[model samples]
Target: METSKVIVEHIFLLVIVTLFSVLQNAFFAVKLEREGKGGNATAFERVSCAVRNCMDAYPTFLAVMWCAGLCVSQGPAAFAGILYLVVRQKYFVGYMGQTSQSTPGFMFGKRPIFFLILMCMVGILNYLLGHFYGRCYKAQLETLTSVVAALLLIP
Candidate 1:
């Protein structure tokens, strides 16, 4: 697919995911508020905590996603973004259900962010080396990306 197309698609998906998250949080807040009226303060606190946790990570997700997309590859960046969001939603749901059950999703979600960060660094390095020294590391990058894809099962 074309780079522009991939970036557009990635942004579109991000918007959708962001909207869904907003709606979900609103619903949860209302539900938790109602529960709080019935003297279930814990539910309200749980929802608040869950929302807070997700919000805390949102900026980092956006930064790494854009960096990787612009610098590295849009397709892989979009794929990693999807993976992160999916696992993040799972983490949110699990946290609301049972805090302990959120561990796996929380851990898994970080992997994509880490991968994106790695990609961003690699992309920057590739640009620098190529521009400054006229040394192309395209093959090295391909090899590294292949290894990472295999490790992350990003097919």
Candidate 2:
């Protein structure tokens, strides 16, 4: 059983996931604004689509994780919690497209390009395994999350 505080932290991780997704959509809004000749409405409209989807999915995602945490305790499930927060930040930056010679910092940060390959790979695996295995207590599901947690722990 995950402690009450840790479960609270776990919920914070979910918020972090949503925040990163919002950051990505905000970056897209910057692009949208540029494309729209600096029209704020157009930028808001463009970014809202992705933002809405993530917001809508949060409750279901959290509910599933609640079950997983209740079943196996926090240690195993927090593994995915960590993964979601880290990789989504990377994916957010990557999705904003390339930066180069002339303009910079669509959101006021400098970063290397294509550095998210590993982050993305791990994130995808983490997401699928979490979604599939985090909702149940079957042997196979436990085996899968266990394997994934082990793999994540390796240097």
Assess each prediction's global lDDT (C-alpha) against the native: 0.75, 0.44
Count of clashes, each model? 0, 0
Worst 10 residues of 2 by lDDT: 106-115
Candidate with maximal lDDT: 1
Local accuracy of candidate 2 as per-residue lDDT tens digits, 71-132 = 44334444554554344344334433422311322121111111122223334455566788
TM-score of 2: 0.40
For model 1 the local lDDT of residue 149 reads 51
Q: What residue pairs clash in candidate 2, if any at all? A: none
* Candidate 1 residue-wise lDDT, 82-107, digit = tens: 77877887887888888998898898
Question: Which ten contiguous residues of candidate 1 have the minimum total lDDT?
Answer: 146-155
lDDT of 1: 0.75
